[model samples]
Target chain A: MLAEREEQLEALLVEREVEQFLYYEAELLDNRELHEWFDHVADDINYRMPRRLMRENTASVFSERGYYFNEDYGSLKARVERFDSEYAWAERPPTRTRRYVTNVRVTRDDEALAEDELFVEANLLVYLSRGDSEKHTFFSARREDVLRRRGDTFEIADREIRLDQTVLSTDNISIFL
Target chain B: MAAGDKPSVTEQALQDARDSLDEGFFPLEFFHDENLHDLEMERIFGQAWVFIGHESEIPEPGDYARRYIGDDAFIFVRDESGEVNLLFDSCRHRGAQVCRAEQGNTSHFRCPYHGWTYKNDGDAAGIPQKSKAFKNLDREEYGLAHVPRLETYEGLVFASLAEEGPSFEEWLGDFKWYFDVHMKLPEGGMEVIGEPHRWVIDANWKTIADNFNGDSYHTAWAHGSVLDLELGGEETVGHAGTGDSLDRHIHCDGHTTSMRGFEDEDVFLTYPEGVVEDLFTKEDLSDAQWKLARQALSFTGAIFPNFGFLHFGDTTDDPEKDVAPFFTIRKWRPLGPDKMELWSWGLAPKNAPEEFKERMYKMYTSNFGPTGNFEQDDVPIWKGITESANGQFASSQNLQLNYQMGLEWMSEMELDDEWLGPGFAYSENLEEGGMRLFHEQWYEMLAGNDRTDATGTPMNVQEDQ
Candidate 1:
C-alpha cells in the first residue's frame, strides 16, 4: 500500500510539471516572444504542419506530399529573424494573437530509450486579430509533440501539427501556432 | 459609402480605363469595381484558355482532381481509354457538384444531394431509383458538360469555356518556349509534388496577375526583407541601385517573361551535380533552345489572364550551401471584385533523387508558398491596394495609378540587336513593359467583340499592328 501511494504521487508530479511547461510555452507564443520561445526548443527539433486534404473515407487524408511549414531548427530561426525586419509587411503592424492550449495529455514512454523523454498531445486554438478589424481568424489544430526533460524544464524535440481545416480560411499563416 | 449608393460601372467607364493604359495610367476603379469584375468573368476568363491541373496530377487511368476555370468548378479526370477530360462539376439532375472531394482516385462520382452518378469520363452512370424517378429521361443527354476546347501543352491542361477563341498555341505564342524551360527538365520532366496550397486573399485577380508579369521593380522595396535576409544576394541590391536588371522583361503577345542571363553560363538553377549535362542533351529541346536555357538564373512570367509561374534558383540560410532551382505555378482565381483564391503548386523533376526533391520542395515552401517569406510580404500589400482602391476618397473614376517607369525609354532600351529569344526583349528587367502589355491585352479582351469561332486570333495582335 505504501509503494502504491508513492507511485500515485510520482504520476501527479509528472503531470504537474508537464502542464506547467505547456502553460509557459503558451504564454511565450501568446506574447509573441519567439526569440525566448526558441530557447525552449531542442536544437534537433523537427516542426512540421502538412497540408490537409479532403479525401474519401477509404483514402488516407494525411498527405506526405506538401506542407504549410516544414522547418528544422535552423530554418525556424531564419523565419523568426524575418519577423524583426521592417519589410516583413505581413507582420509589420504585428498580429495580436492568443494561444489557448488545452486538453494536455502526457504519457511517460514505457519502452523508453531514455528516461528523460515524454510523449504529449494537446489541442490548440489560436485567435488572431490584425489591422483595424474586430474580426478574428480562429485556427485550431491537434498537436502531437515529443518533449525532452532539460535541467529543471522541458524542451520540444518534435512537433507535428494537424490542422483541422482542409482549406485554411485565413489570408496568410503569419503567426506560429 | 452607403448601401446601394455605389456608382454603377458603365461600358464607357471601362473604355476610359482601357484608354488610360497608353498614358502610363490605369483607373483605380478597375481594381475593385463590381461590374468590371462580372464582365471579366464572362469576357476574359470565359473566353481565354484557363489553366486547370497538370496531367501529372491525374496520371492513373481513373484518377481525378477537382479544379477551377475562372469561378466555375471543374473536374480534371483520366478515363479508362487513357484520355484526359475536363468536366463541369455540376450534376445534370439537380446541378449539384458531383465530385465534392478536392481529389481522389475513383471510377465514378456520386452526388450526395441526390444519388446521381457519373463515370470518371463524365458519362452518366446511374441514378438512385432510376425507374421511379423519370422513365422518359434521356441518359445520353445527361452526361457532365465537357469544356468546349481543352488542350495540353507539355502536361499543362488549359480549357476555354467559349466555343471559339484563339488556338491554344496562338494564345501561348512565344511564351511556349519559355514555359518549356519550366516544365521540360531533360530526363523525366516536372511533376507537381502534391495538392496545391490554397488560400483566399482580399485582392483583385488582375492586380496579382499583373504583378507576376514582370513587376521586378517592387522587389527591392516591397520585398527588401528578402535581400536583407541575404536570400537574394548582392545582385538583387544592385538592381535596386542601378535598375540594371530592368532590361530582362520580354514582351510577347499579351504575355511577359523575365529571364536574367547569368555571366557564368554553367551556373544552372538548382539541379544536382551532373544534371545540367543530361538537360543539355535532352532529345526534346533543340540545341539553340538548350543554349538559351543554360544562361538563365531564373525565369518568371504570367500567361495572360491569370496563370503565373516561377522557375528560379535559391539557397538556404547557410551561405555555404549551393543554390538550388525550384518551380512553382499559381493561379489567381477571382472570387469577387476585391477577393481572389490563390492556388499554388510546387513541382520538381520526376527523375530527381528523393533527397534533392525534398530540398526543392523546402526551397519552394520557404520562398513562394503561402507561408513563404516572399508571399507573406506580398499578400498584405495586395490586400492594402484592394482596400485603398475601394475607399471613398479613391473612388473618383479619374483616379489613376502610375505604370510609367520605362515608358520614356521603350525605343532606346530595346534589346533586339543582342537578344536571341522571340518577343520584344527589353534592355532591363525592372521595366513596366510587361505590365503595359498585360493591361493592353486585358483591355483588348474586355473591349473587343466576342469571337464566334475557336480559331479567331487574339484582338491584341490586330490592335498592336
Candidate 2:
C-alpha cells in the first residue's frame, strides 16, 4: 500500500513539472521572445498543423494531403527569423496574443516514447488582437507534443497542432499557434 | 456639388472613377462602398466567366465537392457515367440545401427537408410522396438548375451566371496562347494537389487583382524577408529592372502575365533534369511556345475579374534545401465590400514522381499560402487598404491613388519588338500598365458595356507610331 501511494505522488510531481514548462513556454510566445522560445526546440523538431475537414458523418477528419504547416527545424527557424526584418509588415506592429493552455495530460508509459520522452496533450486557446483596432480573433486547437527531458527542463521534439476551424476567419495566420 | 447638376450617388461615383482612370489614377473610395459592391455583383460577377474548380477534384463517379460562384453554392459532381456537372445546391421542393457535406462521394443527394432526391447528374430521380400525393407534378421539370453557361479549358472549369454573354472561347481569346504554355508544357498535364486552402479576410477583391496584374515593384520590398533568409534567389525575388534576367509584362485579350527569364538559356523554370528531360514535351507546343517555356524562370498572371496564378521556380522552404518549382492558382470571392474569401490550390504535373509532387506541394505552402513566409505580409496590407477606403476621408478628399508608374509622363517605357508570344510585351518590368488595363476592364463591366471595349492596341505601340 505504501509503495503504491509513493508511485501516485511521483506521478503528480511529474505532471506539475510539465504544466510549469508549458506555462513558461506560453509566456515566452506571448512576450514575442521567439528566439528564446526557439531555444527550447529540439534540433530534430517536427512541427505540423494539418488542415481540418468537415463531413456529414464524421466530426473530426483531417486531410491527408492538405496542411497549413509542415516544418522541419530549418524551415521553422527561417519563419521565426523572418519577423526580425523590418519589412515583415505582418508583424511590424506585433500582434498581441494571450495563450490559455489547459487540460494537460502526460503519458509516461507509452511504448512509442523513449524513457526520457513524454507524450503530452493539451487544449490551447490563443486570443489575438492586431493593428490598433477592436478587431480580435481566437485560435482554438488541440496539440499533441513529444517533450524530451534535457537536463533540468524539457524540449519540444515533435508537435502536431490540429486547428478547429476549416475556414480561417483571420486576414492571415501571421502568428504561430 | 450643385443640386440641379447632381447625378445619382452611384453615377457620380462612377463618373469620378472614370475621370481618375483617364488620368492614370483610381479612386480610393470604390474599394468599400456598399452601393458599388451591389452593382459589381449585378454587373461584373454576374456576367463574367468565374473559375469554379479543376476537373481533377472529382475524378471518380459519384464524387462531388461544394463550390461557389458569387454567393451561389453549387455541387461540382461527377455522375455514374463519368460526366461532370455543376448543379445548384438548393432543393426544388422548399429551397433547402441538399448536399450536407463539403465533399463526398454519393450516388444521389436526398434532401433532408422533404426527401427530394437528385441524381449526381442533377436529374430528379424520386419524390417521397410520389403519385399518392401529387400526381400532376412533373419530376422532369424539377431538376436542379445548372448555371447558365459552364465551360472547361485544359481541365479548368469556369461558369457564367448570365445566359447571354461572350462565349468562353471568345472570352479567353488570344490569352489562351499564353496559358497554353502552362497547361501543355508537362506530359499528362497538371493536376491539383489536394483540397484548396481557404481563408476569409477583410479586404477588397480588387486589391489582390492589382497585385497579380504585374505589380512587380512590390516583390523586393513586400517580400524582403524571403530574400533576407535566402529562401529565394535574388533573380526570382529581386528588384525590378535591376537584374540581367529578361523581364516582360505581356497583356493579351484583357488578361495579363508578367514573366522573368534568362536570354537564350535552357532555364526551363529551373525544373530538375529528371522532369525536364522526361516530362516536358514539345509535341503540343509550337517552336515559339517551346522556346518561351525553355527560357522561363517564373510566370505570374491573372484572368479578368478574379482568377490569378503563379508558376515559380528557384525557391525553397529552407535555404539548406535544393530549390524546386511550385504552381498555384487562386480566386478572390467577394463577401462584402470589406471582406473576401481567398481560395488557393497547389498543383503539379500529373505524371511526375510521387516524391517530387509532394515536394512541389511543400514549396507552394511555404511560399504562397495563408501561412507562407512571403504571403503572410501581403494579406494584412491589402486589408489595411480596404480599411483606409472605408471612411469618409477618402471620398471627401477626392483621393486619387496613382497608377501612373509607366505612363508617358512617368517613364519612357517601350514595347518588345522581338516578342515570341501572342501578346504585346513590355520590354521592362518596371511598369503599372497592367493595373491600368485591369481598371479599364472593371470600369467597362460596371458601366454595363462589354469588357472587351477596353481592349485595343497597346498604348506604347501608339506612342511609338
DockQ of each: 0.68, 0.83
The estimated TM-scores of all candidates read 0.94, 0.97
What is the C-alpha lDDT profile of model 2 across B1-465, one tens digit per residue?
A: 344321223865696668667568898887877777888899999999999999999999999999998889999999999988999999999999999888889999999998999999999999987999769999999998888899989899999999999999999989998899999999999999878999999999999999999999999999998899888889999999888999999999889999999989999888899999999999899999999999999999999989999999999998888999999999999998889999999999999999999899999999988998889999999998998987767877878899988777888798888999987899999998889889998988888999998877655456668
**In candidate 2, which residue pairs get closer than 3 Å at backbone N, Cα or C atoms, i.e. clash?**
none
Model 2: residue B177 alpha-carbon error in angstroms: 1.4
Off by over 4 Å in 1: A58-60, A110-113, B1-5, B131-133, B236-247, B279-282, B317-320, B409-412, B450-465
Which stretches of candidate 2 lie above 4 Å from their native place?
A: B1-9
> What range of 10 consecutive residues in model 1 chain B has the weakest lDDT sum?
B451-460
lDDT of 1 by residue, B1-465 (tens): 358546857888777667666667887767887888888898988898888988999999989888997778999999989899999999898899888788888899888898899998999899788888778888888999999999998888998998987899988877677777667755778888977999887888878877898887787777777777776654532352263332377777667787765643664664666666654354776655676676666777998888998877754543335667778998889999998999899988887777777888888888886788778888878887787777555665467888876665342343544666667666666467677777777776777653222112223323344
CAPRI-style docking class of model 2 based on DockQ: high
- Lowest lDDT 10-mer window, candidate 2 chain B? B1-10
